[model samples]
Target: MKKLGITLLVATLFVSCSLSKVEKSARKTVDGNWQLNSVTYDEKGVFNTHLLNDVTATCFENSQWFFRSNNSTGTYNILDSDCSTGVRNFRWAANEIGKDSGVFDFTLKFTDDKKKDIEKNTGYRMNLKYLDDNHMQITQTIQFEGKPFNINMNFTRTTL
Candidate 1:
């Protein structure tokens, strides 16, 4: 009976570690500042949309972003004078879908500066399509006209 109890405890602890191989790799590579170079759709056409349930899609272009892998928290600044000009804080995670698969289930939860959740039970999930030291791409697929439409947000690492 004693051995069984110890075995169960060990199993629980192993499962609770949580971070997968890909997630750890992604977090390390994503730590730093980045510039949102563009927002594009997989299909060639103009479509109006909002990103991360916030401002218009156009507002994300050329925005500055910062990610802290240590705490999984980040901030983005919308610099367009014509649009909302402010910093938005968010908590994010890169969850690996399979064992060392290089694919991740990315989730973002908007928060206040104090790191309090802005909305209860509400957040966004996207796919971490690609990531490297200098570049990263995230895609959110939504239903448009009963078909899947992909919204891609591209980012490039920046200094300072």
Candidate 2:
């Protein structure tokens, strides 16, 4: 009976230790190339899906975002089908203001020849959600035309 008790305790301890290790290693990093897969828009509490079918979605169809782990800098390539191709240089930082909060702050500036001389700068504070090895979603709320709009963009990892 004594041997059986000792063996059971050892087994439990082993299992617990392995689980903790797995949990720690399962955290995913945002370093890699990610492609924009889809987006959803919420207006006045109404949710609209299948936003990629619209004509404006063509501008973002071939969009790609590359994030670097070393310096937290990235580039967004906008390969618009109908419009001119452009690239935006951005610096991103993850913010954990709360215990369970995961937010991303991005500052974007045009790097193309035409807009390179322009002083227009865009920034966004978005919440990072459902981030895993292959998939991630970002949500942002903005005011457009005197109305509140919530946009959710989904991405898929394209590089290792």
Candidate 3:
């Protein structure tokens, strides 16, 4: 019984370390500047909606983003003349759901420039659906009329 207990402990430790490494590698890939190229949905039709409970979906298009994986912090700016333009800071994390699964539970929280959390009890959780050196996608699912609605935010890596 003691040997079995020790074996389980060792296994758990190994998994924990492995997951940490996986998450770090994924975050490294996301470090840099990106552009929110477009916003799409899973279903069809003209559905006007707000994203992140703060801005309309159209307002996010072409937004500029900067990420610092080393510190788990980032900022995005809305550039459209028709929308409010400013820098919004946030802390983000990419957590691998499985070993080498390439799927992650990405989370973002609003913060101040000093990295202090601004939304004390609210944050956004989304799926890191796809990621690569040049392109990435995040999906946020919300309920609409008692059904799941997916909001897909596509991004492209950029410089400057």
TM-score of each: 0.92, 0.60, 0.87
Best by lDDT: 1
Give candidate 2's whole-model lDDT: 0.60
RMSD of 3: 3.9
Q: Which digits, one per residue and each the tens of the lDDT, describe model 3 over residues 1-160?
A: 9999999999999886654666887798899999999999999988888888778889999999998998899999999989988889999989988667878999999999899999799999999999888999999999999999999999999997
Ordered by lDDT, highest first, the candidates read 1, 3, 2
Candidate structures ordered by TM-score, highest first: 1, 3, 2
lDDT of 3: 0.91
Model 1, position 89: C-alpha lDDT score: 96
Put down candidate 2 lDDT per residue, 1-160, tens digits, no spaces.
Answer: 9999999999999885542322232223667899988776765555433232223444666589887656556776777757556666666655543334343432333334333423455455676655788887777667677987767778898963
- Angstrom error at residue 102, model 1: 0.6
lDDT of residue 90 for candidate 3: 95
Model 3 TM-score, all chains together: 0.87
Candidate 2: segments with Cα more than 4 A from true spot:
1-28, 43-57, 102-122, 144-147
Candidate 1 vs candidate 3, TM-score winner: 1
lDDT (C-alpha, whole model) for all candidates: 0.92, 0.60, 0.91
Please report, as a residue range, the 10-residue window in candidate 1 with the lowest summed lDDT. Answer: 16-25
